[model samples]
Target: MASSQEFVQYAADQSSGAGRITYRKMFGEYGMYCDGKIFALVCDDQFFIKITNAGKRLAPGLTETPPYEGAKPYFLIEDLDDRDFLTEFITATCSELPMPKPRNKRKSNDTVPKRRHQNDF
Candidate 1:
């Protein structure tokens, strides 16, 4: 099942204290970002935070699972009500993660060349 919009909003709101939290639709689920760095995912109505040494230190027994099949295992966070804990943990995780690289801008003149088919040739 796909994650509910309410669940993604709650997750983002809970972690807002840590930084500028945002969520984007990805693969029919949601990817949560903190200050431009993706740090978590909301899939199947569950929240899965990216695993980091800092996060492991915070929750020693954190459940780990991939939000999607064949993806890297993430820390499966079940405590969504604990606002303080959620914010702090997110802060720690983001601290350990590198900032996102800036995206390259496409030149206005950039365009894809059409391929000539055998019939057209």
Candidate 2:
């Protein structure tokens, strides 16, 4: 099942204190980004934060679960109401993660040439 928009908004609002929190639709779910770095995912109406060493140190008690099938376990945050904890944990997780690399864009002039059949050649 896909994640609800309400839940995604709630999660984003909860983490607003951390930084510039934003989310984008990805693979039928939501990927939450803080300050341009994706740090969490809202999948199947559940929030899964990226598991990091800093996060472990901050919230060792938090449970871990995979956001989806065949994926690494993330910190399965249950206490969504705790804004302070969310902010702190989100901040720490972002700190441990490397900055996102800039996306490579194709030049305006770049175009794929059409394939020609042997008969045409």
Candidate 3:
């Protein structure tokens, strides 16, 4: 398994041209989040972009493996040296995703009205 620091470095290097990519340590692996949304993950020193129908078609040879046991499948980016292909894949994935909705800033308690107990029937 790749160390979190190493994975972060790898993600940073791979996403040099991409704007403001951030790496967060998650479940012993590293999740690469672009603009506050997850776009990729790093495991065993390999970068895997989130799989989509277009990405699957573009890189049919790439394996769709679960990041962890019993997890959903993600596109395993086998060729780290292929920058052009990686870039295209990233672009395509980003384009296909709908614009992220703004997260509600209100606290859960504040959002939910307080319940009052009434006499039992």
Candidate 4:
């Protein structure tokens, strides 16, 4: 799996427009987020955008497969060597996504009660 930093850099280079693109490690792979919604994923050094109704219509030939075992549908950019097609796919996927919401700042430990399973009732 590629490092999150490496994945983000690659996504940044592939992306266009003024919109910000971010990446985070997810399910042992890299997930690309535009605004806040996940638009794409990187696995085995390949990019695959989330399947959208619009994208399905635009690129009907694209394959919808899980990036890994027991994963959701993702549109794999079969021709990774084709930069033009990759860019177009990314742009279309990002356009359909809404801006991401800010993540909560609370710490995991802070939210957990000190007592273990106190409310058994």
Candidate 5:
């Protein structure tokens, strides 16, 4: 089942301490990003944070579960009421995740051949 927008927004608002929290449609679910790095996801109304060493250290009793089918387990965050803890935990986790890869740049002329000047050769 698809997650509700209200739930996604609540997740973003709760993690605002991480800085510039945003959510996007990702593979029929929602991807929570901060500073261009995806740190968590909202699937089926459940919030799941990426399993990072920092996260594991912060919450040792985290319930590990996959956000979707055929995916690795993430730290299932059940307590969203505590905004401070969520922000702190998510900030630490985001620090461990790598930034998004730069997109490939292609020159426009590469696709269409350049026209030769009519000057005498």
Candidate 6:
């Protein structure tokens, strides 16, 4: 099931203190980012933050669960009511995650070469 828009908006708002909170729809779910680095995911209306040593230390005792199939376990944050905790936790989590690498841009003239067949000779 896809995550609800309300849930996604709420999650983003809750973590807004972390700075530049945004989200993108992915495979029927949502990947949440803070300052361009993904830190969490909202899947099926559940909140899951990437598990890092810093995050683990900050949110001790949080359950571990995969946000989606075939994925590593993340910190399952059940308590979303506390804005203060959410902001602090998200901030620490973003700090733990490395910034996204720049993507190589393709030139307008870039194109695949035509395959030459034996008949062409």
**Which structure among the candidates has the greatest lDDT?**
2
Cα-based lDDT for every prediction: 0.92, 0.94, 0.74, 0.72, 0.91, 0.90
What's each prediction's TM-score? 0.88, 0.89, 0.73, 0.66, 0.87, 0.87
- Per candidate, the number of residue pairs that clash is 0, 0, 0, 2, 0, 0
Candidate 1 lDDT, 33-88, residue by residue in tens: 99999999999989999999999999999899998899999999998999999988
Off by over 4 Å in 3: 106-121
**Which ten contiguous residues of candidate 5 have the minimum total lDDT?**
112-121
Query: Candidate 6: worst 10 consecutive residues by lDDT?
Result: 106-115
- Using TM-score as the yardstick, the better of models 2 and 5 is 2
lDDT of 6: 0.90
TM-score of 5: 0.87
Best-matching candidate per TM-score: 2
Candidate 1 displacement at residue 35 in angstroms: 1.1
Which segments of model 5 are wrong by more than 4 Å? 106-110, 113-121
CA lDDT of 18 in candidate 5?
81
lDDT over C-alpha atoms for residue 66 of model 4: 86
User: Candidate 3 on 83-121: residue-level lDDT in tens?
Assistant: 677667777776676656888887777778767668632
**What is candidate 1's CA lDDT for residue 120?**
100
lDDT of 4 by residue, 14-56 (tens): 6544246777788677877766667888887777788877788
Considering lDDT, which of the candidate structures 5 and 6 is the better prediction for this target?
5
Worst 10 residues of 1 by lDDT: 106-115
Evaluation by lDDT, superior candidate among 2 and 6: 2
lDDT at residue 51 of model 3 (Cα atoms): 82
